[model samples]
Target chain A: MQALSFEQAPPPSVPIRFFLTAPLFMLLAGLLLLIDGEAVMASRWTPAALALTHLMTAGFMLQVMLGALFQLMPVAAGANLWRPSVLALPVHLLSAIGAVLLVAAFHHQIAWAYQLAVVAIGCSVLAFVPAGMLALSRPPGTSHSLIALRIALLAFFATVLAGATMALARAGLIDTGWLRFSSSHVALGLAGWGCVLVAAVGYLVVPMFQLTPAYPRWFARSFAPLMVLAIGLGMVVLHPTAWLPLIGLVALFASVTLDRQQRRRRAKLDATFRFWRFAMGCVLFACAGSVLMIFNIGGNAVALAVGVLAILGGFVSVISGMLYKIVPFILWLYLQPRVQGVPPMTRMLNEQWVLWHLRAHVAMIGAALLATLWWPAVYLVGSLMVVSAALLGGQLLRVVGRARAALRLAQPS
Target chain B: MTDRLPPIVVDARRLLPPEPMERTLEALDEMQPGQEVLLMIPRQPAPLFDMLHNNGYAYTVESQPDGVFHITIRQASGD
Candidate 1:
């Protein structure tokens, strides 16, 4: 008696497609929140800000971050992802449902949205922590970006907890700022998860595709946590009321160094570089403004605006721009060849198409910063964000479509 | 003539650079003429072969039921 066995077939790039599109969805969410910019900025309509903002942070940003980790960690740690296919559905559903409900509650005046957000974000965080740890558990391969991500994941979890705390507090569950946990959450989220992770990814991806050398190892390693430590001390030490200023200085230095390195890179010197410049300038100017504020130079609101603008407009812009290249590259590698493979992911998609998105993201970043200063620019910035997200999302969906086609051809009926 | 060919079987999966197989093929492009290469890949690596072929590389794809994909390359003599 003989038995026949069937072979399992896999599609390479569907997850990458999701990673690329989810951010576009988030960008659109940010644009919607900006529709009522001044009020949201002033906290008059916190719901709009919280909802729209988290969509960017959680929906747009974290979505890609988590997806990329899944893809990259396997390579970086020299270990296969545990439960790779099995993990996607639950992770995606919980995160999506949780993010949307959380945002809707905040934006639409539903009190439960806060509760929903906590549950969803908490679950997503739970899923992400294990996955991230597992990915990093393998030996740190030579990729500086993965090493940075390994360190940044710790900060990412901190922000997630802070976010959960803020949600609970808003729901009237617990009291005490927990060391101004709300603000701490934003700092950790922006710098720790968003900034550090993006930087880590940037460190590797920039050089890999662009033919640039890695940034000085010690400098990149020291940069994030130094600012993070300063911030933590400022919050806890009380003796270091001056530490906030110190943190700003460190952040400024990091930005300037990154700007210098990007310029020195020998890659295509394309729109990606220009976007990097825009983001660096925004952060540098804001940090300088914050230092002036420390000396009691500017009005409190204006100073706050400068800092916030830097985080949202500058940092986020740089991230969005980087994604224009990165998402496509990943998709092309994972998905494009199925559509086209001898070229495989290498030249699966048009580099020129990616450049168009980079240009648009840069334009949107500038518009977003201008909107931060002027009220009317809000509508224009919002529209630009919407457009950018649309282009990016559409591109990703196309990759998924291609992946499906490749699977069919490969599966052999 | 095909039956006379020696089975090309080299476990090249580990040797392939740490990227999608297609990009790894770029390294192969630099191979010297007359280099006879045997690649053993996970069935997953079939996509890499499809791509190399699409790029106009001369290759023969044969599947063994044990799930080891055998891809043999005849070196391109620069014309």
Candidate 2:
């Protein structure tokens, strides 16, 4: 067993910085949707649509995922990072700036922007992947979460490399047929990196937060490797039907999560619990959409629906839910000993605001799915998205503000 | 003749996160000198160990067969 090093936990600012900044990207995505609603909703390949997608994925998702890893690796996995506070600065800055540049490159098709974005994001990943790998290499024990985390990191690396190759090709820097691997890039990113990482964290947090029983040992141990294998087979086969196994695997994960959640020990159905349930339902819906793709059922409209369900409906909802629990708990943990009257973690944030955000988010997802079918609904989707992002950002700031107030009160005159 | 108080037992195996840590700290705060506490939790309380060490307490952790962790903690002799 690895000795736990809670002492090595980075100062709260490390993760909190990333958390606080993440929502701005989501807000940016909302603004982009408002500005180019018609073109963005028309098809996935449109410049505005590409910008909108990256703003959510690379901008918002990457920030929170990296931040969570900085905290989670040490506490849960006993994989202490080397000076995490120092490491977080460059990673956060490059990631945020690179994401912006990438969105600009896609939206404007600016050649120089593509080159700069590729370099900036490439360096950010380079800095993070090695540090993460080194920490994960000799974790205290080989828990299933740690095993999945290791694979997820490798997948993240491959995803970034693939993205860089495609970006370079787009900039006319090289023409090695890298664009043909678009599906592979998406597979590695969403499944290999995104879903696997979620699985890794889910194994740890679902039981901890929801008071659910642990995932079955066999499922936890095998899920990440199996996901990677399916993604690999999909890449090699280069056929639409090859995605069936991957889709089945994702559906299995979603169904299993829903099953476990049904038996939660906790009596209260908090926002976080509800968000997870909603996200899982979206995942199942997205799986159905993917199956439609295999059979050429709805064309690009089906593809758009799948994207909406998977990214905005599923990942965004889940990430927002996790932030509610994580940010409050982190703040409470920081203040408990120092502040004379620190609030409980649950009370650290305004629950009314959280509920409002949840409602807005749900409506936003519904609007987005509808917009995929009827493009005019994109305006309502954009508005709800803005409202949702604002509420989430406002609540996070309120928690930080509370922490600051308590700290000030504890100070000696 | 010397009389020693038995260690206080705080069973936190059924509780979640901060509750276990909170209860343990409360027990520690109320402890008499020379008394110890046995905290039973579902998982290794790594963060609590740091808190205890920083606050001049010593602890030993043993894993139980049923998957609970038994952490024995006491104030250091000098403190």
Candidate 3:
């Protein structure tokens, strides 16, 4: 039989640059909360609230997701991203600048800011989405993770188009018809892009990192396609009820993931695993709240509560957990060849800092939920969120610094 | 370092990326003539196959029904 061969992953710097920038956005989001606490709590559609939401979704979440994808495309999917380092420089810069401009546009209602944001973020997406799709176009080997990545990329493109349309409408460059597409935008971003990507990565990492058994073939194969179909239906129907199945599928994914984590062969539980389990629990809770709201049992209060749970509790928790594992692992891997005595992956970062971050993250999520229910708690939410972001960012930077120091030591004198 | 040593076994099923790849490479580097390395991993180490071929190594892979892959690599005939 012919030998099996695949492309190597991009140099560690490509992903690490994105990783290092993500927490700054989270920090910005936290500071935004502190600056506009009362205004942010008033209404979800308010300018301040919109800015805050995008800061988390586009700024924090998308950065980390892209970074992870860069690392995974070659290693897991056997697909080579075209000149990743060269491409990532512009993509990362534009994405960061665009997120800032877009949030600033919302906060200040500046037309120029919105226009510039459209150009910058539009360029970033144009660069990233197509490159990613092309890599997956004919991957060397077929796996559930690769398929899921493809589906998520398509969803990400659709989400970006919808968001750009909405931005144009807000800028008075388009008619109000685009405004009606808001719900579709949220569905595409959260369900289509965010949850599907997470599910895809979870399929690969949950088993590999946690020493758990492979996810059932049936579930791994079908989940993303079903989610894509549900998202398509929801977009066409243009009603909240259409999202019912999509949410149901996410909850099922979470349930199965938690079940698998429970069956992990490794008995020693770490903070990353805790973060994952907690995130799964949050997803379930979010879905339940979504169901209640869709059936008209609860009003805007319930909707806000659900958003908080999904965005903060579910997505942030999972991303933080992954960062804890992925960052240190990458550092350890990159340092292995250059350094004579490289440390274990676990030694790249201080476990105490990770555990501390986890505790603070939990507190931040709780405070966020409380703030959703009662506006008075926004201050607590803001403070805890700032601390959580700082803690997570500090840990990541420390690991990178350690890796650099090792590289320096290994250099020939 | 003896040529008659049993093939060194590297079980990488539970480990994540770079670990499996790293261990496999290390085993190949230390392999003596007529010695082999047996790798037990969850997925096909496709990238490694190319590296080995470029370096004039011979290998065979067996895919288990349960999705695990068993790969055996040895040095090509002569120096």
Candidate 4:
């Protein structure tokens, strides 16, 4: 029998490349969104403002999250999907086109783009459904991460459908939004789908990469219900009200509790831990901002603040820190097999890269939040965020390069 | 004399569970009247002599210079 060789497998398919490239797209999308925001308020550009939202959600978050889920699920669940390459090609193409058209349609007010985006995104979800169900249907002993992903994907589908319908309304295909359609989309997309996936991934990634023990069962068990309640209640209220506060309360309580649980992890604190803390801080701020917006205490600015807090502040911190581990590990997993005892994957990349990105991510987050208050310095913060995100993306790609170089050296003559 | 070695087949996953493997102990207890069993393991998880002392199965564990080991287990105890 031949020895195990990691490099024997051909390169990861297009879906993987698309995923690895997502952070970069997010930087560009975010830059555009911030510029558009500046233009919207200044009357320099007639902007829907919703384009900025989709640019972040569909452009940044959805692309990265979906790709990561496809790769990680097989490994964690031992599901060993029979045709990962086949699934990735079309999924990436469809989703990318969908996100682009959606952004164009809404931002430029092009009706055809909106219709095309709906068909593309809806088709992408349909392609994913069977693979997701097959992976989830397997017997017990699957990782808890996979279980969370299955549920989160359902929420993702719901969020997409709602958002597509709202887009149709924008195209005059439907009369909506006193109907609470936009609010429903935000709840499902941000709070229901994105929040749940983030929290669930935190459970596995934090422990696996950081060498921390499992999250306490209490927090893990509490997450699903709170996420569901937040989405369900938000739909009922459709605006900031007493019921909305209840949703915020549950979400805030959950974030605080999760932070406390993460703190108790005694692994001699690293920057990843700092990311976890930062995410919690953002979550708490988002809760306050959301509730305030619901009460009409701060006008519509509160929603923008909440959006920035959740996306740039919460998700960005978590993903950047996690990449500190994931990039190096992927490098080591594929390369270290050839080196055979030279250095571990963590040694290949150091904590400094994480700290570097952390500062940049945090700085940009500060600047973006500042933009909400000043509205003029949006790009200054956005520039900081975009540069930092781009730097982090480049570093991850470099690890892939390093892995490929090592494999070339080991191939038999 | 130089000789060719046949490729050995092993089931990797089956080896993981049911720890503290005892080849002689199992062979002596279950060998079909004078039948012998050949055991191949990377390393013995349980002591071979003690396994024989406790069960009195006929066996020999031949340690190879490389990692793997070979053991011959013949029925010698409980029938």
Q: Which candidate's DockQ is highest?
A: 2
TM-score of chain A of each: 0.82, 0.97, 0.97, 0.87
- Candidate 2 Cα RMSD (Å): 2.7
Model 1 chain A lowest lDDT segment of ten: A1-10
Q: Chain B TM-score of model 2, please?
A: 0.92
State the C-alpha lDDT per candidate: 0.59, 0.87, 0.85, 0.63
Expressed as tens digits, the lDDT of each residue in A1-413 for candidate 2 is: 22345566678899999999999999999988898999998889899998999999999999999999998888778788888988999999999999999999999999899999998999999899999999999766888889988998998899889988988888899995988878888889888889988888888778777767678888998999899889999999978899899999999888888888997766778888889999999999999999998899998889999999999988998899899988877877888778875766666788888999999999998898889889989999999988988999999999899888888899866
Give me the displacement of residue A397 in model 2, in angstroms: 1.1
Candidate 1 regions exceeding 4 Å error are: A1-14, A30-35, A41-45, A140-147, A176-179, A224-228, A239-267, A292-297, A300-312, A331-356, A406-412, B1-79
Worst lDDT 10-window in candidate 3 chain A: A1-10
Candidate 4 chain A TM is 0.87
List native contact recovery per candidate, as a fraction of 1: 0.06, 0.40, 0.40, 0.00
Evaluate every candidate with DockQ and list the scores.
Answer: 0.08, 0.37, 0.31, 0.03
TM-score of 4: 0.75
What's candidate 4's DockQ score? 0.03
What is model 3's native contact fraction? 0.40
List, residue by residue over A1-413, the lDDT tens digit for candidate 1: 00001011213342563476475555657567456666555542367666667777777767767666665555433445567677766676777777777777667766577788888878877876777677676654545555667667888888878877777777767874653675567667776667677666665555444334445667665666675666576557654245465446446555644655554524436555666666676776776666665567755455545645565556666665565555545445554444434234434345566567766666765665555566566666677677767766666666556556666776667
TM-score, predicted candidate 1 vs. hidden true structure? 0.74
Give a tens-digit lDDT track for model 4, residues B1-79: 6352332223211232111132233343465555666666544433343435455666666776654456665546634
Greater DockQ among 1 and 4 belongs to 1
- Please state the error at residue B52 of candidate 4 in Å: 28
Structure candidate 3, residue pairs in collision: none
